[model samples]
Target chain A: MKESFSQSMDWLHTWAGLLFGWLLFAIFFTGTLSVFDQEITRWMQPELHRVTPAPLDLDAASRTLNQLAPHADRWVITLPYDRKPVGAIGWQHDGLSTLKAIDSRTGTVIPRRETRGGDFFFRFHYQLLLDQPGIWIVGVSAMAMLAVLVTGIVIHHRIFKDFFTFRPSASFHRSWLDAHNVTGVLVFPFHVMITFTGLVIFWAIYMPAGIQTRYEGDMNAFWAEAELFFEREPANQPAPLVSLADLEREARNHWKDGQTRSIVVEHPGDRHALVHMYRRSDDRLSLDSGRVTFDGAGGALRAVWLNENPAYLTQSVLTGLHFVRFGGSPMRWLYFGMGLAASAMIATGLVLWVVKRQGRHAGADAVGYRLVEGLNVAAVAGLLVATATFFWANRLLLPDLEARDLWELRIFFAAWSLCLGHALLHEFLRDGASLKIWTTQLVLAALLFGLLPILNAFTTESHLFVTLPQGQWHLAAVDLTTLMGGLVLGWTAWRLHHPVRTSARSCHTQPVSSSSGSIGSS
Target chain B: MSLAAFLLSYGGLFALCLAMPKHYRAMCGANALPPRPVLLMTRIAGWLILGLSFVASVDAVGWAFGPVQWVGYLAMSGLVLVFGLPYSPRLVLLLGILAFLAVPLTIILI
Candidate 1:
């Protein structure tokens, strides 16, 4: 029998997705969470909880940079934005590199900050637990996913027909298939663009011939030219540097009316040293931005290269688009929504796999079945539990513990591995009460996320309720999210545990309950 | 320690799978064959190669070390050969080339 195009596509989509569903799920979940990365970073640092206007002393900050960076080859200063409490950002480089905040009025050192809240998750999302290679592996998986998407579209003849179809009460497989198709069709453009761009971002590793052949094997040389936005300047000879305040003034002139946001001193205190002040303005090259560079000793106006210029504007635009830096709150919300949809798509695809395979119970007790069952439990419930464990670890970890970053990462992977093992063992035992098992994890998630804020308040004085009204929203946002997530999970658990079938079954069998034991499959 | 532990767990799973009794032919479904043990040598080697590929990613991300520069590539190519004449060798080769070409070009452009 000849399969119709739509049928062919359905077949292609189902099998291809089922083949790598777990990987796709991980990528989508992590990528979606990456949308709120900054907020997470804000929440984790309990010490820097104030939201008040903490602008820095520019004069003193300038003086400090001048004094410390007598021979700094180059430097860039990033002014705090609306998210941070203070414009207290300061930078200086001599033999040492320091990023300190100043008392907006007094210019005192705010020192290096602690707390790895959202940033930890954001970074960990893309770059798995295993260091640099982990990121590449994740990237590879993402690329594979892009292939899956394209192939899926090619095979699906009735894309429009399935666009809005969602039948929740249908058979499990039918429901999962419908939900997956809906996510795939509605955000088709977003899914394609995101995956394509993601692959393009890592093209150099996947295809280096253009560089190796063109640059004649000098990767560094290629990078030197390629990384024009943040040019690496050679160190300069020792010499007195000029005023940073002056550079700021010079940079503002290019903007016509805007303000200065950063300062870069190249080869500070050397014969070849130059100082650059970046004006904060919206231009064609916002990513390739800011201005003002000058000879240090003589104070001659040099070329302005704060990530700007017509030739490299396209890359600047691409970078801006990739990072979503050009837009404000609305764009971030859009990205968040898209991310959630992407995750839902992957989850539905996995569910569809189980539903389809269940119909073919030709060898239900076979090795393949056992393996798939274990994977289903592990990837679905176990992954969530592992992720929750990460938050739990963060809460329990001692603040002053040495190598806390590594320890935090260790907890994530260790917990994940443990879950995978547990899933395999439980699946081997013919566990039929999946709903019961899943409900337990959801309840745990609800409790931990629900109590997180109260715990934060007890453990630290810088609680979000105190921080939010003042303008510091990071901590408040994290707490609010946790509490909300807890409520959602608690509800989900209740629903799963007290499912409609269970209620109906119990009512029907109530009269014979005393005689019958183990009414439902255990 | 991590490497050794991974090997042991993978090895044990391989062994356990192999020892599972294949249902008697009379009891088996008409089309179903008895479950055969997934060979220890094959699973162990496959996993080891996978681990190496993961390590190769380290070199790629860490130093952008010259392409095909990691020790894992040696194990990786060997492992890929294991299915020994996969039905679609040409396609796999093409994909491999594409992946190799794509990663570096993007890095340069980026």
Candidate 2:
């Protein structure tokens, strides 16, 4: 209970990361997958999923919006990407919310896309579902992550010397220690910066003391500028507004090849109805800040809003850096590799905790080591199985079921909890706690994954090989990734206890030597 | 790649090449680290990376200066690698500095 600063940090790091590590890992793991979320969303819903994306019919969408909500000030539409075919449009009305999707051709509002089922897992990563406090918790966790990154770099004395030193079979703790230190050091900068920026990105919302102190305690004044929602204007004149059709053209001309995503109308029906449009460009990886504003009643054009060199607002710059919308896929790849490294670092940290505690409590039964080991099983191994089960649940669940969204999310947590239960029970039954749990999860995961495509064949009648040209590659990618993960888990499980089988002679001698036989830093 | 781009990319790569060897001697080759020739090459690489960053900053403006944006990542990466030397607390500090500037630097073009 009484430890040094480093020791307290050790406590903080262990419990903080351990308690939420699964959540964080699930968050992070899902988040990384969310980098391709829209794609995955498409994959999950085979009914509307696409392999070859349909062309964006801006005119049709435009016409439909004008016809459907002519009285409303602004209309927002999300263009079809490589994932989904249906276009989503939402217009604001007084106290009411008007959200509908239109078919590309008929301009009809179809049923809102399948409920936010699978998306719950993705959203839960950051949102935590606990409301405002949840944000603070995640924000604090992110800052702690930054601290962990820094302290990790500080503690690992010979980091650069072993830039790529991941020697397996070294010793349970030794090998895991090496992996933790190496990966942590290699990506320390990224880990720290990303975590810091991620926290800062939502700084005002999370820690608003500064804004409250400076801006007369008015959060609106702060949000007004942050989101660029200009102060609402008074409506003295009764002037008929000009069509948003013109502003759309102007945005198209400026950001040629990019389509408009939204037109936010502030103070509709006023003398000055302000139309703000969000448009994307073709030159780069991410959507640009090429937004145009208009005085709707006067039909006058306001200045276009492009993101200045990120230096304008500290928050803007930090948001851009952490979210990685800057240079495109390569930087994303760079960040992603670092993220995976962080994941490895965390995994190794868990193993190190187990292996180190294993010795101090070497009596055939040590509660602390066993507890840590159980956590390792559930958090590390069980979380992975849950992730795969999510995909399996997607394939098995009916798209139109009334409670489909709730059902999908329930399966994810249910599977996760089941894996947790297995972790608790498996270690008690088998001599090699890690190996047995891993093998069991591996086999289960593999069986679930390998059978997914066949289940899809049986359930939906949608086959990946045939769906390729139909913009359904998203489904194929998920199925393929699941199968691959299954194989990896199965392989790791097999390797865990293989030595004991081949040479049972030294079973007594191998006394938990090192590396706990979990998957490598690879 | 532009001069800035080339320097950043190559500088970081070179530093990584040296860094890995120096850190994990048993598992890897004796990268020209700490040795005369390798140290000299690393110093030169460091200088070049810095020089390119300087060039990039000069050529750059509000944010999207072509050279600065192009070369910035390499310079940052190389900087991370070099400063992340063995037993040096400076590596941690340098990363802190980078974290401070990460917003300004990474979002060059915003």
Q: Quick one: best TM-score, which candidate?
A: 2
Instruction: Give a tens-digit lDDT track for model 2, residues A1-522.
Output: 433766866666666656655555655665556555555666665665432345545566656666777656455667654335667676766655565656766556666335453455547656766667777778777766766666565556566655444434445555567667766665565666667776766776877787778998787886555455454554655565566666677777866576676666665556867777787433342334567778867767766656554544455655556555445444444555566566667777766766665545544566555655766777777777777777777766665777676687788789889988877775555533655676677677777776776676676646665655565455666666666766766765665555222222221112344444443211
- What does candidate 1's lDDT look like per residue over A90-188, in tens digits? 344445554555555555555433345455665666666556787687677777687678777776545554332343333344445656766776566
What DockQ does each prediction reach against the true complex? 0.01, 0.06
Give the number of the best model, judged by DockQ: 2
Give the DockQ (C-alpha) for candidate 1: 0.01
Interface RMSD of each: 19.4, 10.5
| Residue range B22-109, candidate 1, lDDT tens digits | 2111122224443344344544554564454445444333322212122223222322221111223343334334544554454456
In order, candidate lDDTs are 0.55, 0.58
**DockQ score for model 2:** 0.06
All candidates: TM-score: 0.68, 0.73
Model 2 score (lDDT): 0.58
What are the chain B TM-scores of all models? Answer: 0.28, 0.35
